[model samples]
Target chain A: MAMSQATAAGPRRNRVLNGILVNGTLALICLLWLVPLLGLLVSSFRERSDITTSGWWTVFPHKSYISAKQDQLTKGLALDKPIQVEGVSLTDDQLRAGYTLPDGRKLIWANRRARIVDVQTSQWTTKANFTTANYQAVVLGQTYTYKQSDGSTKTEVGEDMSKAFINSLTVAIPATVIPILLAAFAAYAFAWMRFPGRRPLFAMVVGLLVVPSQVALIPLLRAFSNLHVNGTYLSLWLVHTGFGLSLAIYLLYNYISGLPREILESAFIDGASPFTIFLRLILPLSVPALASFAIFQFMWVWNDYLYALIFLGSTPDTQVLTIKLANLIGSRGQDWHLLTAGAFISMILPLVVFFSLQRYFVRGLLAGSVKG
Target chain B: MIHQTRDAENKRASSAATSGWIPGQFFAGLLGVVVVIALLWAGFIYLRAARSASILNAIVAIIWGVGGIGALFYVSNTLIEALPQKSRDRIRPFLFFGPGVVILFLFLTIPTLITLYQSFFNNDTTRFVGLSNYIATFTDRSMLESFRNNLIWLFLGTGFCVSFGLLIAVLADRSKFESLAKAIIFMPMAISLVGASVIWRFMYAYAPADQPQIGVLNAVLTSLGLQPQSWLTLQPWNNLFLVAVLIWGSTGFAMVLFSAALKGVPGDLLEAARVDGATEVQTFFAIIIPYIQGTILTVTTTTAIGTLKIFDQVFVMTGGQYGTEVVGTEFYRQFFTNRNFGYGAAIAIVLFIAISPVLVYNLRQLQKQEGF
Candidate 1:
């Protein structure tokens, strides 16, 4: 009995150790993945000065003191006499150099100004670390007044992202809906109709799936220019629909074809026309497939930069979020406060759709990749 | 019974073909088509006029795009149904397939062929250049750099994404907090690559040695007594840093695919292996790995294709500066910035050639699946 018990305990311990190892590795990877995004999120809420001067991770509440400027403590005071701040009297020499506060805080004078550092834990709150000003600046545009070298004031307005946000929606919704509708129709035909060139046409779609979109860029740009639609939202919608059609058709075909034949056969016997059957039966039953493709196409169109860059010129009025955000990166490379907020704004919609409809998205991804 | 019903349906279809077309139905269908076209035209005008970023404009665009397309399809189908049955049967499939086919041909097929033709021409298409453009693609200094950098991105980016994806997928399987862990890792997939570039740019932010390092990586390095380094401009290693951004953004995609594949591995097989006294690692290697080999291939090829065409990250992050040029950026620079149409087309074609093997392999896989 003792030997058996020892053996059981050994294996049980090994299993627990194995579980710990696996979980630990995953936890680390997850943390590593989250850090970049989290840092950006935290930085987006920070003041520009703070973002430039310190790390975003430093925003958390910690055992640190707060410092007040000398002017604040010495307001309306006589500097010739001994200065008392927070019940601590400072000698003239100590005031010029540095002194320790009675409450375990340090007082220092640097750059000809007095500074009183509050006691440890006196300012441990995280509240001061965050602000929504960056977001406000990005979405609503902020104005700044600067004192010119000639002693005049100059006011400047920041870029507003609201137009780009609207442009992205205008592009994505139509691009997504058009392709899904067109692909659903084509998928129904490919799955059920007995057309003469059906096999080869579907094969062409499958072949086109891997054709790099790079090959189409220059020629399409030239074509769109000739047609005079180069900078229009219509151009992008059409381009997205065309490029996204193959995968959309392929995924929907896989789902629609797998549907049981009995329902369709019975509908035929009831004298339902092909169009009616498609509208009333095939479509209703293929909602999941349609949904998956919709999510896929929507995300693809929303995140696209190259096509929008080429087709929908980077005019502020026509640029999508991806283009606008990229331009921000270019124009404000050093402005992390603005870049972070812009990045987060661009990501919010896709992230919401991804999380809320993640089940359909995953199903779409699996269907696209893992065919039986 | 199925055969009898099919025969009756065919008879009815043929009989309908013999029946004369109804003028009333045809005219009504034509009127419906006219109405849809008018509605679409009006919507397009409204959308073009209301270029301002207002909520009302967004609402109109959404409704017009979604509802107008629905109307078009409905009317198109009704028009087809009003035709003589013989003509209707012949035209019906095209109604479903025509728009997609036309768009694909216009946007994908014809443009690809045009790009091929354009590759044989000079910068302005004023002179024929033959294989000179292709030669430059292979021999130019910057093009060579792009090729080398592309290779690095392909191997390291694809390698890290697949390995980490698999590792995380295997680790997170059945673990507590599995969904949360997966969600954190997968969240990046929803973000635009431009947003991702912004995130990593912050992660790799730099400052002078004495200045506080705001970037998290540099902050850690400095706190640990190391000199702060410029991560994005640090020579050949900078390429790896760029690739790291791709890894961070795409590993989630690979992980989701692997998780689904891992789940498909049967439990009974694992139980049998364990019962045979095989270790968990041995079972995983011998059983699970082999079981999901197809998914592994799919993930590898997909990620490899993406890495080869990697643009937005490299474009936004480094702007192909600091020796981080890839094919996509090179194509953009040549085509748009420098106006080297032939060179850009050649580079685009080179990308097509590189991706062809995978394309053929994917097609062959589809054909094989069909054969089964």
Candidate 2:
């Protein structure tokens, strides 16, 4: 009783000790978790000049400066030349060539002995000459060609991110929703129905889960060719629907079957038709399951570079966000700032999805774990 | 007596059973049979939909036999069966589930069986050259690498992601910012696998040949006074690097599942342990873990199965370069890139065989939860 009460009531020492360990671990993990995202975010805000001049970490506060004046001198101070550096540089030629000194007499070297030369040197500095030029390049315009105010040619390249973003949403929302909607109906049937070949039907759906979507590509292409449904959102939607249906159905089946049988039966007894029962009883209740699959399908379809690349790649207008973003990676993804910003843009939908429907994800996972 | 007995049997056969419960079951089974027949009829109709079938009346013939007859059976049965008595109670669920079954058969099953047949065919799928494509799958250099890399990916990638996810999930539980912390880990789950691949591609970006390396890792290395390294170009290891993306994308899923299980761990049990003088760590291990062990197993299997089917990321990122090939991507490459149908199908079969145990385990686990 004493021990129990002591542990429950007050444990200044234990609380302090345990608190330190837990909080430390939490802080460490959070920091580790945020590192990559922080790297990407800070990198996105930096200008090309700033990126070249200083690290992203150095961009925020420190007001260090890198100054060089080729106009002031030719030789002794390596403005464009070699030797002296670190803030203000002094040169004898500046004293000789141009301005008068504080002294009344003009200053010069011993004579016109040393020939004046252009200041040219390897100039490298890591200081705070940062700007928001990278962000500017993203939003309004860039160095690419566009029609100008006077109707003459001007290179005003805007961020390609916005259009690709919309394009992705157009392809993704339907691509994700279509398969899920189609698959949910399929999953419900596979779970609760008794047909002549129900087991075989389900086994095939599950079997298709393992059959790589690639195996179907040629056949699909040939089928599409024969049907002449190629090169449209409908074609790509069909492709995503076909590819995603098996897994979505498999996932939803796991949940739909688990719903209390009585609720469905009661609905049936209430003189409701199958469609009515599904809409009122099944669909609303299956929101968690549906949302989880929606999240998966949405993310997959959104991030889908392959299907989009293969099916939609025949035309530029149909390319999705992933394909667009990937191509922006220089066919290799070397443009860091654009990559980061583009990543953020591409991820916005999923993040909103995850955060908003996160509770369902939690529920879905628990159900998946505890039940099966 | 024979006539009376036969009449009784006929009446019994029309409904579920002699008992009330069996009527719904019987009706359900009858409904299923009707749906199967109707769908087959539709296919029979489409098959007969040839433009040459009685040329002038082909449209009329196609419409009359297929959808028309199928609808007739459906409507007639539905109207006759409207009494909604026992034995026929199952018809409701069957009605709900029937459309899904037909679609699954048409889209998923037919395509799969066709692949099996096509797997034995020549390059263009016209002529049957038995086992030739399968033979080439084993011999080709790319196929061999793909197979080997897939093996590596299946074992190592799945293993690491699940374990790390479990470990982090354990850490994040009972924290002040559990939701916030989870959101960070879960954030990556929302990004498209290809989007993530694109993001990571920039992280692995390398600039050589007179260019100062601008990639973040390189910049960090240079800042820390170390030489830069080309990360992705590093072969065998690069596969692991690519696998990291799959890991990143999947861990959040694992974490969410585990966290839910953690939430279900029963707080009083941990409190009891603490009162019993067990340390916080000891209490966590002893009390909290056993309750959620089933959940951990489920997450591991889910992640493992998902890992086996990784295609889009590898396809998007490396195009399976740097020894990063997995079965899903390999199957596609062979089917599409190499134009070898049999080889691709064979590879898919191999993946199917590889994943079957995992699938069975998952299904068994789910069934156990549902008590089916």
Candidate 3:
């Protein structure tokens, strides 16, 4: 519409410029928006050494050699010609490491831990060397074999998110479901029922909506520790349920109150109790609000780091995906392959929920923020 | 015809309804609620006492929490059925409102009060050291840095998210590929902050000048023949790098909301503006922006509140290293890692105080939206 306005008012030349400017800006911003995700996606399939050796974009160019010179190796070298290993010609003194061969085979040195690459692929290849090894290493907690200083190989198990993934599910599912049930029931009451102090009570619930979860952390952690539920799935479930309550009630109340009172009044005249009206009528009619809140709660609990870190602690058995992922960043900071794959693993479910239910998700955002 | 008939019937039915009165069954429903809660707690304890928890225990507890709560509502409904009809009406609200309010009070309100009380004490909370912890929060170097970084996060993070969101919304509107483009831009909102951090970490990934830079930013710089910089470890600026991650996630959210708001801006108004000989730019600035002012304020306030509590990005990327600390992560470090409870409590309270004004404003907006 704005573009049409521009065309109607502006000179023809300016109109052409505006079209290019608007489309180009949107395309550019969209690309910028996607850059990090693109980086992560590309990095996930790369081998560990390749991930560390070059940018993910370089995977397209396919010049895959890591060239390093070591003068120590030159002292006793007698060869005059350059040393050609896998089509990568390195001077006799130079150490050519982390290279891919002409046939696209990678030469890995166990002791030196370097990739041998050709660095000479000129033609545009239709194929790429993508591996799920990083994902395998992350999901299955695969072991990495490292050579000791004494020349023996030792395998150390990588930090796997399998158990933490389970822990996250265990924490998130009950946390999400319990709050919705409680909130939906409460919302129905707040919306339709006449009760003393209902207005002030709903106001109080709304007031609590903005209480930063930070203030609750220290005291709750101390209390949970005393109750011996600090690191348990029950504690997380309970806390998430508590934290999600106010918004859940608010959003659900907004939706339920706007429902046709005729349905409830008719049900009441039919000898159905208020509880029956809520259970059979209100709940069914309010599914959209319930679903939106459920997705919000589920995503919040799943992606939460501070609560999981503090309440659950960083113990291997009790850690959730966020805590584990953060730890992975700390311990294996340069292990981009692992981080990328693990990041995706952590995000996959939320992404699926978001895309599949984007309409509800956006509706929830609007209802929770601007209008209702 | 149906709408008018229903409206008349709704008014007549409402005016014809009898005045509500409390019945003795109300007390029975109230008693049933307490009894169910007690039973649920006992069941939880019994489950915990039976054995040290395994995955099976977690699953069973989840089932108990979700199913038991549902059963409690059902049982309470059945108990209320024995009450006289009028009493059941008065008591049903209690049954509905009980569980959710109780949880919020127990977890959020009560803990927040305890946290406030603990802030005046010493680290172990044994000795009274009134104002010392609060003083330390302002005087301490890291805490001050965190405060400063939080301010930057609030401004820059909210600013970019709102601005980019508005820009994208305006540009994408009425475009042929609007939905597709918006979907791609909105993709990152689905990712957890931890995942976003990992993704951005790869973008800011740095290798020494000798190695090919793997991070997209550093790679771009290197390809431009500039020195590769360690984006995360660069002092002060690393704070902005961390903020960028939040902006990346929030912009999509703001954009979706703004796009919805833009749609609410009437087409006839824009036509009126154009007919008055207003330029496209003038129309957007005068008419469109003002129309979406409420949405803009809401997005900005919410995003500002979120940015004030920035945690996961700083934690994952730098672990508050290189002077990138924010209040949330600082609270984590002091409470969990440093084992300084009082300081942590103080920081939490400080964050609470900082967010209170925003919270009040948001509540006021909600009230206004409710037409109160």
Candidate 4:
């Protein structure tokens, strides 16, 4: 009895150790994956000055020790009154103009709070730093007043992303819906209907699956220009539909063909015409497949950058979020405040759809990739 | 027996057909075609006119683009039903499949052929320049750099994604928090490459050595008593940094696929190995890896294709500067910025040729599975 109990205890201990190892590894990887996104999320909510001055992880409430010169201390502060630093009283105007400290460290005021700086470092504690201003600036235009070298104030307006958000929706909806609709019909034909060259045609689609879109870029650009449809939403919608058709058809075909043969045979025996049977029976029965393809197409079209960039162009009137965000990275490379918010805005919709209908999305992925 | 049943169904379909309405049905079909064309044209015009960013314009475009296509399919199907049985049978499949096929031919196949033909022409396409563009693609200095960088991205990016993905998937499979862990890792797949660049841009943000390092990476380096590095501008190694962004964004895709493939490994098989005194590591390498070998290939090729066409991350992060140039960016620069049509077309064709082996492999796999 003791021998059996010892053997059982050994395997149990092994199982416990195995569980810890598995969970520990997954937790580490999960943390690694989450940190970058978490940093971006945190930075998006931070004030512009804070983003430029410190790492996003610093936004966590903590005590910071840092040495700063008087000029460096005055940069982000908006002082309202005179303050005494190491027995020297300094007014707001004096601080703004320039103040020199004997030891290059002094008391500084920011956001109506004062902290002492030492020759080595200063002790400053902060609550969790947070702000919604970055999002406001990215979604709604923010105006900045800068004093130029000539002492003239210049007001520059930041780019508003609300319009680009709308443009992305405009591009994604049709680009998603049209291809699925067209591919559903084609997939049905490929699955159930007998036609000449159907086998070869279906094979051709599978071949087209790996044809990189780069090959079509130049000629299509020329064609669009000649057709006077360059930089239009219609052009993007058409191009996306064409590019997305093969996979849409392939995934839908896999599901539609696997549907029980009895149902189709019974509908035929009942003398229902092919089109009616398709409309009344096949389509309704194929909802799960249709839904999987819909989610796939929607996400693909929403997250598309290359096609949208090349086909739609980056004009303010037509650019999608990907194009707009990419442009922000180019023109405002240093504007992390705008970029973090813009990037979040661009991903929010797809993220929402992905989380909500993730089962269908996963189903689509498995169907597309693991046929065997 | 199947052929006889099909013949009987055909006879029944013919008997149910309404005769003596040929001209009316023909005109009705013509009218349906015209209506579809007109509706599509109107939607296109409205979409083009709504270049201004407004919620109202977005709503209108969605309705017209989506609703208009829906109406076209409905009308075409109805008109086809009105035709006599002989014509209907001959035309029904086309009615379902025509639009998708036409779009594919116009947007993908024909344009790819045009790009191939244009590759033989001069920059302006006014003269034949046979093989020069191809030679330049091979011999050009910048092109060679792009090829080398692309090779780096292809191997490193695909390798990291697949291995990390396989690791995460395998570990998560045995955890109680499987869904949540998988969800967090999979979340990045929903983000666009542009958004991912922005996210990592914050992670890799750098400051001068004198100032506090704002980027997390540099901040960690400084805290560890190391000199901060400019991750993006640090040549040669910068390509790896950019490739890291791709891996971060795509590993989730590989993981989901691997996770699904892992589930397909029979529980009993794993149990048998464990009972046979095999260690987990031994079982993983001996049993699990071989079981999922096909999925590994699929994930590798898929990720490789994506890396080969690496554009958005490189464009947004480094703009292909600091020796991080790849074929996708090179194609964009030659085609759009430089207006080197022949050269750009050659680059695109080169990309297509590079992908053909994988394409052929996928086709062969599909043929073996479906017995085509």
Clashing pairs in 3: A97-A115, A98-A115, A98-A116, A99-A115, A99-A116, A99-A117, A100-A116, A100-A117, B23-B87
User: Which is the better candidate, 2 or 4, if ranked by DockQ?
Assistant: 4
Q: Each candidate's lDDT (Cα)?
A: 0.83, 0.62, 0.80, 0.82
Can you tell me which runs of candidate 2 are displaced by over 4 Å? A1-11, A52-54, A62-163, A179-211, A247-276, A284-288, A364-372, B1-94, B127-129, B207-213, B272-290, B366-371
lDDT tens digits, residue span B23-135, model 4: 66567767987988897787777777656656576567667755766677777766776667667788888877777777788888999999999999999888999999999
| Residue B366 alpha-carbon offset, candidate 1, angstroms | 1.9
The parts of candidate 4 lying over 4 Å away from their true place are A66-124, A144-156, B1-23, B53-87
Q: Each prediction's DockQ?
A: 0.53, 0.24, 0.47, 0.55
Residue-level lDDT tens digits of model 3 in A241-351: 889999999999889989987887886666555665676788889899988998988899999987888777788877889998988888888767788999999999999
Instruction: Give lDDT tens digits, candidate 2, residues A1-372.
Output: 999978866677767776677667867866665666666667776654444334455645543322222333333333333223223334644634533334322332322234332322323434444445545554443543433434587454445566566666666665566555556666776666665556656666665665555546656667776765565554565677677777777778888887899988875555454544555677788888888777767767877776777666624555667776667664425445556666677777778877787776566455434554
For each candidate, give the TM-score of chain B: 0.91, 0.72, 0.86, 0.92
Q: Model 2 misses residue B214 by how many Å? A: 3.4
Tens-place lDDT per residue, model 1, A1-372, is 999998899889988998888888888888899999899989888877778776787777655445644334644456677777657776657766556665666665543343432332245655346788788888999864434545587665666898799889988887788788778888888888877787778877887888899999888888777766678776787688889999999999999989999999988777777876787788999999999999988998999998989888788877889999999888878878788998999999999999999999989999997772
- How many Å off is the CA of B289 in candidate 4? 1.1
State the interface C-alpha RMSD of candidate 1. Answer: 3.0
Candidate closest to the true structure, highest lDDT: 1
Off by over 4 Å in 3: A1-17, A61-127, A144-156, B1-35, B46-59, B84-88, B366-372
Q: What digit string (tens of lDDT, one per residue) describes model 4 on residues A64-143?
A: 54545432244434456665555687876554434556764544432224432332344555636687877778888786
- What is the alpha-carbon lDDT of model 3 when measured against the actual structure? 0.80
What's the CA error at residue A134 for candidate 1, in Å?
Answer: 1.7
lDDT of 2 by residue, B1-372 (tens): 534644443464445233333545446646766776677555444533332212233234334333443453355345434443543554544554455455555555666667777878876777888887778777878778877787777778778777777677777775677777778877777777766776666556565524555556776777687777777768888888788777767778877777777777777877778778998668767776777777767676667667777887777777777777777787777767777777777776666566678667655544454323
